[model samples]
Target: MTLSSLPAPAAPTVSPWTLSAFWFGTAFHWLLLLIILIPANVVGFVGEANKGTYLGALTAVGAIMALVLPPLVGAHSDRTGKRLPYIRLGLAVNLAGLGVMALAASLMTGTNGFLVYVLGFLLVQFGNNYATAPYSALIPQLVPPSLRGRYSGVMGMLQAVGQLLGAVVAFAVGTLNLPVFVSFAVIAVVLLVPALITMRGVPETATPAPELAAGPTLSWQQLFSYQPFLWVFITRVLFALGQYSVQPFLQYYSVDVLNQKDGVTASSLLAGCIIVASILSAFLGGRISDRVGRKPVIYVAGTTMALTAILLLIAPGFGTALALAVVFGLGFGAFTSVDWALGSDAMPSAKSYARDMGIWHVAFVGPQFIGAPQGALLDWGNRQGDNLGYTLVFGIAAAFFMLGVLLVRNVPDTAHVKTAKA
Candidate 1:
């Protein structure tokens, strides 16, 4: 049926959001982070020889899910006209995976337990991506373009909160004892189930797909033809290259380059600084984007963060390193806040919001596919004398960030343009 055939709801001149819309952000982030942490220690302890193979294999599996599931689920949601049901399904998959992981750990010992953990991990990745694709599509629907920046800012804060909470859980559940891991799973479900319950009742108004119904059903090929959407995807992937590449190596950098006595502690402090700064900036930057524009904020953020990547290479001491962390944190926070809003603004088709968003989701997940290659580069560089690997790592990260900034120009910016309603 054509979208025009579908009944239309009263169209608001301008879209706006109440404060409660942001609650989804907090719940989504918290549960996602909690579930991820559940397997981190197991992954980390794999011997160096097999570590690369296991991680590479796992990342490939996870990245495939990341790239494929979001849009698939998103497209499904768009067709079905019910977002929450898919969200609930994804959560159930996630919870099932967590249960199997806990069960396997309880029944098996040593490497056998770890093997089951791997299976569970893959399932969790699949479920999370499926859930996240549909859930993310909700943002554009719930918050109007006029208020998207502010909404994104709140989402950013929620993301920070989720990260902090996840970190706390990881620390608390250190060593991955079977009982502790089980308890961790229980706690995650307890927290997340309620959030899902709350979201189930949040009242999403389904808009008729006039353009979508009139046109051919949304196809991947059709989605890719939109230049602005393509650029948005490119920029996001570039940004991910810079961000995720460094994340895995920071602790190693702390110990080898900074001579920190406690690598883990130092890395955590640096990460904490970045998180705190991001929380503030995301809130502030989103507000600023509302008044100014999304691109300008991203430009400033991208530039600042790119420079910080350089500073990481040159920092002489822990104090200098910590200061750089603050700078990176601020830049990253600003970027995080505006990132999604910009994506929302750049969408090619409102009728396919979830499906289009699923396409956008590839950028974040694409990194997983490429991370092994990036790590390989780091490894190759490290084999050379004088920590050249670290230099190459940060240098590559900086280049990716700059490339993202340049690509930003190609994307049609909606944050600056006003519609009749806006």
Candidate 2:
């Protein structure tokens, strides 16, 4: 069938979410970083001797689930027109996985521990993606286009705050193996309960069942032909690749390369600095994107990230790393806040928002899978002697960031396009 033959999607009639609902809805993400990603990294670092390879394997395994599950559930949600049910289901799975992770890490030994942790993380990844995909779709579905930037900013703020709190907790538990896992498990529940409770009052804005009878079916060529979306997807894939290439190892780098006696302190300090800067930038970047547009903000963000990576290569000590974290945070905050809004603006169709967003998510998770190769690079580099592996990773990361900056230029700011059409 020709692309024109597909029915135009119905205009979305979603209402603005209340501040309370927004807060609760987003709170889940804040805790997600601390409970899931941070703990997984720490576990990977501590669980095995070859930290790079072990961490890589774990992340690679989890990436498969991250890649597969969300889009499936998201597509399902698109058809069923229910977002929260998946979220609730994901919560149960995540909580169960968290408990199992804690128990596994505590009871298992050596390689056994590593395997268990990997298993637990796969579950966490599944649960996390399942819940998050729908939540992500909510922005485009519910938020008025005019307010998308501001709303994204607010969401970014919540995420930054969550990271800040998570950083504090991560530092407290730093490298303490079972305690870190246990803490994450407990905190996940503590934060999640209120989020779920608060979200209970928020309305779901799914397409009606009758309306979905003849939903638009997209061909691969037709889907890829959407220039704005293609660019956005490509941009994020590069961004995630660069970001994760270094992210999982920052703590290890701090201790192993920087020679910090305390790895946990170093990691927490870096995260804290980024969070502090991100807190302000997240709000401001989002607000600014509303006025100026997303492309420029994203360009600035990508550039800042590239510069930050370069600085990491030459950073003198802990103090310098802290300072550079500020730069990184500024760029990250802007990119994260504005980029999300950009993605929403670039949605190909409201009828398949969840499904398309799932494909979009592949950009984010795709990097994790791609980055597994970097672990081999890390191992190869470290084997060569003078901590060359660390340097190489940062260099590659910087290159990726720069490339993303260039790519963003091609993606039209969908907000402006919409305005032009209006």
Candidate 3:
């Protein structure tokens, strides 16, 4: 069957709970690793003085693996017409990597330990990308257009909750002075349980044989030419760049800027504060976008996030920063809630959902590399005196956020609720 002759596949709607379940685990895994464990591990190995530069370099290297793996995994899964087997394989590898990371943390110290941790982190990235690339296609494959916004909202809410959980874990690690390896063990369980629930609960719909046979092989030229997808992809990258510029260094920011005695606990508290607000906004944003439109919500959300980033530069104390974090969370939650729906709507072909969404996933990881230089910049600005680095980086983040909001205007809106109402 040629593409033109293929009929639309029936959309299989799932319970919101089931639809959102797998993401909870995935979000927990990543948020814990990125926001908490990795920073702490880096500090253990490198100490506070050089943490920013080293962490940036380490993250950049790991991001290379994350960036390269997903599209390949997704394309292969599309060809095989299977997602679950790959997900299982990836999960096993991811667990093994976590174990190695725990070993590195518990046994080793200094540069050697950091290198071993890096090796383990690379493996974790590899496995995560391998699994999630195919997993990302589930939304477009399962949900119909009209319901994607609301479903994506639920997914976002669960993701926020997962981050909140991660923050709690971080707080425990900091306050109790828990062993680093123990934290890894905790994350492993947190990741594993929900993933199993999702895999068992969510059934995959088979791709029609004719459509599989007819699906065009993926090519970079074709991928770039899809205008709507390209615009969405660009916007996603911009938003992520804004986010990552600040995210990896929050521990340092709390210690250096906020003058917190235990930076880990302070950063974790800030993260918890943000996530609490995010949980609420994520649901509301998703539902509201369903009724109103994606673009308008995006405009407001992006602006709010940009302003918050700017505000963080001037926050005089942790208390004031905590308040701003709430505002930031509201914006970020809304953006993330709508982001999945936007990407799903802009997908070029249903026949290659995994491949396309895998590429879309890069929009998130690619920024880790692109913005990696912010670490060096942060170090440099501090050297110049008056804590200039934080100011410069956060300012840049605000600019990136605003530019993303502006560029998103180029993509044609595809909100189903408005279309249905019309």
Candidate 4:
């Protein structure tokens, strides 16, 4: 069942839609491309691109930029005491970047595929990455602590919805892929404009603890000083890398391996299962994290994501793979269920929420650059008769989960920050 079908959390002070907006961002945020790319991410890189390495390198450059932009912009926002300016500017970048990608994709289909493909992908990623930095950090200002877990669940749920919608939508529009993608982006932008307009005068909460902000004087060194916060970045990077490897290859498995005809039925079912499970997991998982603790949830998600990735690799057919998608989504829902709250806790700077989040974002976005191509290459190599190549990639994904377990092990749980209702 979809998380949207689940009962509401106990009375939250923040209007439900506010939290819903936060959660909904996930689904709508990249609703434009994720669905089409998610199942096809692997195929696009390995089979279609035929130049994974070059495309990967370019994607990496853009991904890296996204990683670093958040903290810088956020800190600047903190200094300015305003975030909308940066938000608006970044949104503009997002629009321009999507436009380039559409243009690039259109060009690649006919000829000179390599150069145009790389450039378009790079531009789209660059814009999204840059914009996302400040976007994530802005959450704290919007949601209250009593509702962090619930809010996070909403965020996770919306994201899954986006995936479900995007996947089904993509299959229908694959023939008109370019315009479909552009329209998706355009709609996202339209949604964003209204959201931002709503948030125009809305104030976000800053750090309540004096020690965390240094008695009113905020400094970058103090912000970066928290080692645990840095550790979040470490885990984020691993998560991104592992995710990247699996996402791009899913399409390849369906098309080249399973030999499924290109249709919304197959893609939608695949995307739908993963997202549906993820949203359910995300909703309950966030509250569970709130109850038992965040670290435990992270562990659950990490291991689940890792195991499922491997299962898909070893499984004999699409049925098993589809089943695993549900499992994978469950794991992801659990981890990300409270990930944003955990991320906020790790932030060392009050003023630069976006900046620090942005800096931390690298761990999430960077891997996509390398992971996509690497998965493709491994698949490409395995297609040549070496099982170890693909196996190794999945293995590494699992290893990253293990590594994340270690990274968050020492992190202090925020359970006492607010007790969950019995």
RMSD of each: 4.5, 3.7, 2.5, 6.4
TM-score of candidate 4 versus the correct structure, residues matched by position: 0.81
Error of 1 at 279 (Å): 0.8
Candidate 1, pairs of clashing residues = 3-213
In terms of lDDT, the poorest run of 10 residues in model 4 is 1-10
Query: 254-335 in candidate 3: lDDT tens per residue?
Result: 9889999888899999999889999999999888888877888889999999999999889988899999999999998999
lDDT of 2 by residue, 291-354 (tens): 8888888889899999899888788888898999999999988887776678888776667777
Candidate number with greatest lDDT:
3
**Model 4 misplacement above 4 A:** 1-16, 19-51, 107-117, 142-144, 175-225, 263-268, 372-376, 386-388, 415-422
- What is candidate 4's lDDT per residue for 182-300, written digit by digit as tens? 55465456546545643543345422233323323335565445665666777877787777665554544555445577633455567778888888888887777666767888888
What is the C-alpha local distance difference test score of candidate 2?
0.72
- Candidate 1 C-alpha lDDT tens digits along 332-418: 989988888887776655567788888797887767765566666666777777878789878989999999998898877556663
TM-scores of the candidates in the order shown: 0.84, 0.88, 0.95, 0.81
Best by TM-score: 3
Clashing residue pairs in candidate 3 (N, C-alpha, C atoms within 3 angstroms): none
* CA lDDT scores, all candidates in order: 0.67, 0.72, 0.84, 0.60
| CA lDDT, candidate 1, residue 224 | 65
Rate residue 144 of model 1 by lDDT. Answer: 65
